[model samples]
Target: MIAPPARPDSLVRQDRFTTDESTADVAVVIVTYRNADSISTLVDSLRSEAAVSSIRVVVVDNNSGDGTASTLAAHDDVIVVAGEVNLGYAGAINVARSRIGATRAVLILNPDCVVQPGCVTALRAALREPGVVAAVPRLHDVDGRLSFSLRREPRLPATLVDAMLGARLPRRPVWASETIRDVAVYDRAHSIEWATGAAMMMSAGALDAVGPWDERFFLYSEETDYFRRLRSHGLVLYVPEARVEHTGGGSGSSQALSDLLTVNKIRYVQKYHARSFVTAFHAVTLFGEAVRCWSSKHRATYRAVARRHEWSNLLRAETPRPTECRDMGSVVIPAHNESRVIARTLDALADLAARGVVEVIVACNGCTDDTARIAAGRPGVRVLDLDVASKTAAMNGADEVAELWPRVYLDADVVITPAAVVDLVTALADGTLLAARPASRYDATGAGHLVRRYYRARSSLPLVRSHLWGAGCYALSEEGHARVGRFPDVVADDVVVDAAFATDEKIVVDTDPVVVLVPRTPAALIAVLSRNYSGNRDAPATTSSTGTLRHVAGTVHGPGTLLDAAVYCLFAALGRRASRRTSARWARDDTSRT
Candidate 1:
């Protein structure tokens, strides 16, 4: 019999990330708590991925005062978001997703992971099939030794066995027989219950359908929750033909986080498994706790985790609400400096708020003006003043504080009637649509040839015809919010939300038309178009979600639309060229401002 390859000799460590960045096709999210040393080495390895088109690196520094953000700040390609409060691993990932915008695939990675050449390629290739939600690469330890990378869900029998024997013997195959087989037989790729969030290339479409990570889980069981959400959507979790070295052991030393992990695990078991299973798990865990009491080295860490209150929360029949329940349907409007139009937007939805069907949450992010004060003045409109300017962050902050579902992500600039808000909530109540957005009527009176032509041609398409996004506003059903949790930190959140569902699952609710302000001038059009282009930067260039005929038919409404299409083509070519020259903070069209 052939013996397994021996672990490679250790190498010297020199920490650095190369300046070279690809034309990013993937948004690589690295949520670091600390371990700046490990992250530096991993970044260096990632720089070697020149074969990959583009890698957008979003480093969410979860208040790691150890200067991890500053360490990565020098790298031009890296976008670092300061989590002044550690949003935990799951929350960080959700923030990273928004920052990623609309990339074809998202890579959820650990700060300590290093990938081999073609690893990303294989992961991306696996996601080409529609059924595959995520693809995990095989993991090797720093020593290039194969670690225990796969396992079935924790069962009571396995737990009892591992506690009774595996804890003591340390190498008994009988303790975790199936897990042992998984490691031994891992010669090829296969389906798994969940992939380690350490390094997995997930389909953006799948993420849209599954939503964001459940922020309730601090760290440990986040992947399990993600898997559960994905599985609920009938998506497959695939293992691809590639390998990555994920240095096991995160900032796992934090006793608080570790305790939370233990609690999350118990909750996971109780939530998914049977009552008997939970009882068995607690019994098995007690045995392990008893074993730990005999081991002096583990007493502190073990005692910190095995708390009665934490266990009781899970064993109880009722689930704890994430936030207060003053409201049922939530309308979260993320604003930066929209003091001019904030009141009007709030007034439009005042009827729904008055009826008690909705509560408006104006998350005023990075507002220097009286946006918050003005929003707060409105009766029934709750104002959330945020320090960060990110729309995704504001939405997340709102989600964090408000225990409301069937959330509506309303754009401050769009003007939709209160009746429309009522219709949206009513539509959401039926559970027919994953998401719904109003049909738009563009303000074309003051527009130029190119600008008017673009909107006219766009209006003919499915976005105006049968699809969404032409309108700035959209509503998420409770199921929609459940499937796709928090808003990602992105400029074009509508596109990201719109991509998460099929036509059958979502709709263009034209009951009450939404008035969209078109760019008044060619210059304004260029500025707005440039921003729009930037919004679409990392997103899929094209998606089959909307068919070809739907795309073309949008341009053929009338002879006038044919002329509109001609001008639109001219501007599109010109716009694409000008868009490249746009800076990160591109100019917005002020034509809509009253």
Candidate 2:
């Protein structure tokens, strides 16, 4: 698996993005943080573009407490999404990309930049070139002079030269300088390694192929990383005719931002190059900062490079860190011979771990398969090999090791996204709620007709919606953990957690729904239901107070659902009978696993 780029809490919050669907051919996506005063000029400038009629303006305000919301509200034609938390530049761009629908191309612009007339038209023309995925516009400073926005890939030889003689060396040779300063190069369209991210255009296909921006650099090298990825698919063309006047010097001038810039340059090198090359790149970058230490920003950069191991801490200082409770939460996944599904579960949690959102521990019990190996390969995920083949034993073992509070216990087959996990963690952070889980979304695409009907009826029941037991994923705070103490040897671990909390103490978070896949065949469905029934029998007596009849009763309202309710009841009865007749053993539906 490709390692997720580590940015300072890039995925810190569940993005609260809302936008409209438009038939516009081009989407102008602007990611802004605290630039309310300057964004209006940029947005208004796009209105005068030659192809303004085909352009849909999308502004993603990254939780800027400034009046950016009010400033954007004035533009009725623009689509504005205000995030609840600061998702950094790359994260906000990702959110904006998701909302672009079927637009032909996306032009990413900084709020501080104004596009000249015909800029979008020229960019679209360049984007239409065969084998071209990205087109970057030539940027001019507010004073109307060219801002050397083009750059060469960071090479050890060029970096060393820059370190020996400062980066501003006017006549530095092309091979020794990282910046592309030849005036002739910007006079006409050409290909480039990368360009300044202030104004860049990409086809929608390029955006889809390149996937997400490497959010590891909160404000710096993310664009470089993305540009490199875009180059892998096709050419990154420079469109000199496309002019954008940029107002620089906000984050770029700050000492902290400069520190990040230096560190992220080294990070970009480390991600793509061998260790030997990364070592050389780091040494050169550090030397350059050391020589220029007279300036406060350079000193900050030097110190940042010196303490490279604490980069995450440095990033935390720059960005608002997640709540202490969020940092302290742990996700415990119990896997027993689950090689088939363990990777899927861990992949969901990888982003959470990369963002420092939670600690993940996968306790593999009696696994003859490669479950433990697969889980260990995931970033920020811990793996344990338990001797017994018991789910309760695995959970208990994981709980013993997980010192953090608000522990989330996830089933190996369940696929819960990082955003949904954040929602559950957020809900559990509330002083009143001790336990939480996301709403359930059952995938019964390949299930038998009767089984699908049974799930349809069962999913509509108020008891299922309100209870935390059926979701396969659930979280418990310290107090909630004390109530459930040690997981008993029961089939339904979720049921135990659910029973531990009173009605007011538990909640179902309204985030992205947790996808729960139903068994494919009728027999397989019954086998899973039978296992659930067996778990229910082993749960505390209080959990059984609500009888099967009561739950089935809620599924029936009119004649339409009456058939579904009957199927649900029949399955429940059959599962109960099967559970009573069969000896206590693990009975999972392997059909979905296959």
Candidate 3:
């Protein structure tokens, strides 16, 4: 645990104080809500030598029922302002802004955030640049994953595109999240449209010009509206060379809060746009909300809030017009012997395809039954029949039929989730050869989570080479496929094709996972794993003997590395146990059938 900076003043001051002898001029305000557990850490992080020597710290305890006041009282550097009741984020920040006074800059930080060393200095330096109104630091989740802190203000059309079709229509799929793309393209010195309120610094001059956050938005969309206001004044938002760790959703978690977020989003649209814009925005948002409420597990709460808002918006007269764009890519499913689940898969694919992300290609590979005929029965679907047993061969067949068009490969048995295909295709960048779709299991066995983690960890390692590409689902560039000499005819063609490229040239995986029905019977699981192991064993070794030895040793005894060999052995034992059970069940079923 990091320690807080020592207090320079004898006593904590309530009102803003001027220090003529300042090195870097800025003040940071953090608002807390029942965050006593993490307040000390947050205060310490903000009061670190790098932050304290340059900036002031203001801790706003939003009438937290927890012992939040005591936590702030212990920190001498923190000027604790206790609210009478639990004020929402916008209200709390507004209170802090009043005490911030005339500093060169003001930083809005969350209580659960910890600034990386020198982050304040970097943000302040970035703001000093001309035309830059605010500079937000790159924020990472507690697990050191990048948060989508930077973003374009959400428009109704963009929301519809994202909700219905997917990000593929954006032309830059790699920039699905506003923050990651902003960090990648915009330099430490470049500008952006908006950023997350998790950790953002604004110049005092800009704040004075644009004014405070829109208080009407009690929670969400306030920052978005603020950035809009800032842009109106010709001040651009900049992302500087700074990093902050954010513990996601520390303050708001209640169903009430979730409803508030939904309602406030509507309020944001109403506040910013004209009557015409508001009308169209409300229509799309309300429709989307109704669908969301109906489908959500928390239907009672979501529906109640959504219906109320919809009724309120219905009385309004004028509405805004929506933007339109060209739809790209066809979702292509290749099937063989999928009579049981072919209709369901096609149905799900059709719903997604209707979003205009990609066209559906249900290429029937070596199917002697109604798989091809069933697929052809669907409207707007072009079905192709192919007499190929190999997975790679099937893909090749699909490619030949859909020549020059980008295609997404979907397995016959797998169920694609809502917007998953769109998300995958939209996230594709210029150099990305393939985009790996995430897979979720039908059962909540936690195996999918572990598999995802394993894939992510292994993918990051420079030594681990990917040869066994998953045939379940993945998208490939038609040109990129041709460039890479097409998919190889191997047992596990996906892995084989994945290994052909350099690590940097392979398909990138996203968090939006596809749902896969795991083998319910142990025999099926073992068969899949055995086939995978066999494919891996037969594939030529990509790593040298020396590298393999090093990998083994690292698995055995490396700092921070778990005993993976033992773990692998344990999983193998579990597989054996499952196989025995499966065999017994199969024997009993056979006897009954006879």
Candidate 4:
């Protein structure tokens, strides 16, 4: 007989630091992810707040690879729960709250945020008000600029209007926008539908009535789902007297997180609203993504919305099991004339190869230099001297010899650490995912001013870092290879591989990023972008040249991004024009290669 499905409570282990029998007036729960750098300041401020009121501090570390748990453990007044698995934000909050004693109110906080003097006291006071289920503090960035933290109930009309008119429209009708833009509204305490989850205080009774935060929403919309539930009980009050200095993006940002944020909005509507509303919400979301589908993130979201049944698995918190193989996998490096950069790249993988964690293969395709000798000199490294100069041909040649189930295709010029390769291999060991790549960290060292400015804008886009391409490396499971088939004879082989899989089938693994060196000069940068343009022209991408223009135009959020966008657009236009006029030969950037 088939058993019923299990509940999605993902917390496997919880540890309490303080065993005090005495209850506190409020419990402050901070969810951390590699936030050891900022956790000290937050803890210091909360320690000061403890002088005015009885407060119990609790920190739940969400399986951070950094020493966040150890840092929190050093605090005697704090209760720290070092999670074995990643219990996202909502699940971490639920876990932290369970360890608290009889507290009147519970405060949720981001690790990279700090509360000002009397802020917690104000929030606790506001939470105690009549008919108030939750209270939120006014949030500001480190620059002291006010954040539009409050939002209206996420309905179809607001979503549609925001999608059409965009969010920057002034004096927008309150019903047509989810974000509350009026500064006057933030001056005084008032009721709100919901606010940012970076910092909030909720009554213990309201929390109990609403039940635990829905962990299925994962990291993004779980708070929205909770607040919607809280509205049934009472109001969510905004306390202007309370302020939090937020160093946003503390937990980090990725294409996956951005896609999660977009898809979960529709998921929320689907949970409470009718079928028609759900369909409309989905359509509005797709329209928004469609408008910006040139952007990597929006393109990814468009794909996510297009594939409905698959994206729901992203909400699952089940951890991947370890594989039986002692040597994790094989790594294939495809090189043409990368002699200058091949040593550094091979040196980065030497430790992993020597440790028997990964077997390294360097496919030197049509190389005249000592690229083959440099790689062959390294222990546990195999060199394939291919006659053709095609990158895809080199990849296919290495694949013919690669015996591992999950194989990594690395560019000869990219530098990736052994730890990141191990993590990436572990992520693919379970065979649930088809493709994965570590995040990218671009080194702008020796880059010209125009090149620097162009990459500055490009790096700000979540898609450039999140997508499998551009990061200089991507891994594919045996199943992924079956789907992608053989390496195509195209300049945009990465694009072809990326297009073959849906958003759910691929991921940008959270690990040490591969280092991609920027072009040293503006001309070299344009030459590389010209190659990209040629590749995009040859490949079957979701975006077009016009879509690319709109995507770059859509990135202009304010004055700072405006200058960057202009530089980026100028280079993009030049690159496209150059690619059209030039021959179909590889317009490679020898600057970084040298």
| lDDT leader | 4
Candidate 4 lDDT for residue 442: 76
Tens digits of per-residue lDDT, candidate 2, 152-249, equal: 99988888888888657767789988888888888988899999899999999899898877554677889999999999999999998999999886
After the best TM-score superposition of candidate 3, give how far the Cα of residue 61 lies from its true spot, in angstroms.
1.2
Q: Which residue pairs clash in candidate 4?
A: none
List candidate 2 stretches off by more than 4 Å. Answer: 1-22, 50-52, 316-594
| 173-276 per-residue lDDT for model 4 (tens digits) | 78888999888899999998999889988888987898767665668888888888899999999999999999888858887787788888876776667656
Q: Which residue runs of candidate 1 sit more than 4 Å off their true CA positions?
A: 1-24, 167-183, 233-240, 296-306, 310-594
Cα-based lDDT for every prediction: 0.68, 0.79, 0.59, 0.81
lDDT of 2: 0.79
Q: Candidate 4: where is the Cα deviation over 4 Å?
A: 1-325, 462-466
- Candidate 1 per-residue lDDT, tens place, 247-308, comes to 88875655555455566666577546655676678667667656757765346436544433
TM-score order, best first, reads 2, 4, 1, 3
lDDT of 2 at 453: 92
- List the candidates' TM-scores in order: 0.50, 0.55, 0.46, 0.52
Q: Which has the better lDDT: candidate 1, or candidate 3?
A: 1
Alpha carbon deviation, residue 391, candidate 3 (Å): 82
539: Cα error in model 1, Å: 55
Estimate candidate 1's alpha-carbon lDDT, on a 0 to 1 scale: 0.68
